[model samples]
Target: MQRFLIALCCLLCSLPAAAWNGAGHRLVAVIAWQQLSAPTRAFVSAALADHPDHSRWVERAGGHGAAAIFAEAATWADSIRNDPRYYDAGRGEPTPPIGGRFDSRRQRHWHYVDLDATGRPVKGELDRQVERLSRLLGTADAPDEITYALPWLAHLVADLHQPLHVGRSDDDGGTRFTVENPFSKRLPFLSLHAYWDELPGPSSLRGRRLQREAARLLSEHRPPAQGDVDLWREESRHLHASAYPHQAGSLLPIVDEAFQRQARATAERRLSEAGYRLGRLLEARLRHRVSRETP
Candidate 1:
């Protein structure tokens, strides 16, 4: 019994750490938080109030507290860095110098494909993760516990919106190719995978201004309809075949242009959709909770 308890303790302790890593995941959280509506924001705020560490940081940061929240989200990504299954194996470890192509087979099977595809989880593992999150949130009655789950859910959903996160199994969704950043000459800081991760918009924007920019883009572009999702899937497949192959060649300018255009469009649509979806979920949940508490 003592041995079992020790093992269980270790496993339990490792679980949170395992979930944390992947900047991609944290980036989703940052985007989701930025895109939240008023009610959704309130729900997130109430949920976060239960978390002393996160709450304390927010409180200390004051009105611009959301910035701190995104910083925390970024930090959380580091915690889950060791979980290999969460990322594409093709990227060959998260560090750098990634080379190779994405597996076509994996792309078909995973719902998390890329800018073109939406909603398919690679190998159906994402559904199980969502189920786990649901269970966790179900048992969590406190605001803090709820807040913890909120970010996780929000972030994961956003990650799914990122076409690269759903990448192919073999090439790990373009994780192998390395490219130089057009904006920076400091180093050859480019990878097919990294390019996808940072796509569509400049990372320089922050706070409400960033949120406003995303909102404006969404207003201008609009979300793809259900029919559009199919088109995206087809386009993603095409991109996988054509773009992934030439990603490493002397086609830097062409590749950069393609990535920028796709990233911008995807970012606007997904960010807008995340806000709408999160608002719907938060409203339903909050209404029920309020009704239950009412005299």
Candidate 2:
């Protein structure tokens, strides 16, 4: 509960309606995982097997098949952030991704790169990690590397596409600003970042049903022109500038139907775009391994 409030504080100043909630992440994951080549799917499954949450994912899978695992994997980074044990005092500040074979803690900063409010891209661990993991996936294909990279890749890709996650030199991605409840009554107000996060979908999308929703979304939207992080960053910048306008002093913005419609459209499209790009990235990197036997 303490961690929840801290995250709530960091996620936004007011009550948290959403900060890229799990249902949205799972929707993005299911859409991407379904498009994977069978070999890529197998590779991803095998990789996720090493995740600390794997057994829990399997148990939660129940009758829904592996879709549950895909969804659960999408939320693992966020789960670890909320987990107190990972934040135990022994772990140093800035929380590095635990190194070596026994490492269990997550690298908190790996999730999002904060671009300056002026929109200059601030280089972050996310960019480096994505590049490194993509290279390893393409050439190295080490089992341990694959196991670690896949989850981070999935989480980070979705994270990059979130508009606020890529913005603001100051503020925890707009966690500093607050707004009236136009999205939902669950919270009386929302932080600017949390508002964008909630734009993707409801807080809990009922597991397997979200997969079906992902499929529907895919049918309606075309795949990305191609996956490019630069393109993703530019896309985020536009969404932030046009749709999420603010005043000089940080007064709260009013959330009305017009704003919600535009944000919702952008978020859904981004979710689909992120998903297709994830599939493309994985397929490009992992397809070479089809002929090699699993280690």
Candidate 3:
């Protein structure tokens, strides 16, 4: 069992430095889907169908239905990290993808907002981008623009719920610090950010298993109250300090059974809240659009 735990830890450590692994993002989408009204779901389906990568998402889901496609699309923002089609801004000039309202540059800074110990923004556009994208999705008249904004908005909302993303820049949102896990003797230390990112479970989780887990999360955790991005960011920021494992006078914090247990619970709660909050946001945005168009 120890060897297996070590292997799992090593595998999780190797995952990309996204807020949550693919499974977590997808699970959030699935849980959100459960809360969405039928009209909101239909709006989502229509908007996604027009996405440039819609076909690719369908293919990846093995031609699954709308729910699977929606779950797949939740990871699209992170998916572009390795995609050559989109280059990081200021890094290089690649011929932009030839399509409607598409900015081919990967907006890496859109993922998180790093605040200083005093709560001043040092970098990252996550808060600003979420508000902008949410507004754009709600008010945009162009189909293509809606397509372009939907995935980004969905993704950023989930990212905003991750405590580290809204946390301090002191340790680069916990990525700079390494925590030792006693469960793994061979590979005892891993980045604190990576440890939190993997708490939602494996990156390959999908399909029925994903749905079941999401359902279980919903059952176990109550939905968060309706709040704007600012409120959400504040909540995450407050939780950030507590995310670090505490050890008296020790530079390195050790992740023992108790710490892991609490961390896992916190991570799961965040995931659940992310899903419910996203659902409410989408429903409001889409329903407003419907009301405007009904005239």
User: TM-score, each model?
Assistant: 0.58, 0.84, 0.89
Q: What would the per-residue lDDT of candidate 1 be over residues 32-84, giving only the tens digit for each residue?
A: 45544555555556555544345534643345566346435433333334434
Once superposed on the true structure, which residue ranges of model 3 sit more than 4 Å away at CA? Answer: 1-17, 98-101, 184-187, 248-251, 291-295
- Candidate order by lDDT, decreasing, is 3, 2, 1
Q: Give residue 40's lDDT in candidate 2 (0 to 100).
A: 75
> Which ten-residue region of model 3 has the weakest summed lDDT?
7-16
Model 1: how far is 173 from its true place, Å?
3.1
Candidate 3's error at 294, in angstroms?
A: 9.2
Whole-model lDDT values for every prediction = 0.45, 0.70, 0.81
Off by over 4 Å in 1: 1-40, 56-62, 65-127, 134-145, 180-189, 200-204, 223-248, 251-259, 293-295
Q: Taking the tens digit of each residue's C-alpha lDDT, what string does model 2 give over 37-124?
A: 8877877788788766678777665556665687777777787776554663456644434433524665666666667757675744
User: TM-score of the candidate numbered 3?
Assistant: 0.89
Where model 2 places Cα greater than 4 Å from the true spot, the runs are 1-19, 88-102, 245-251
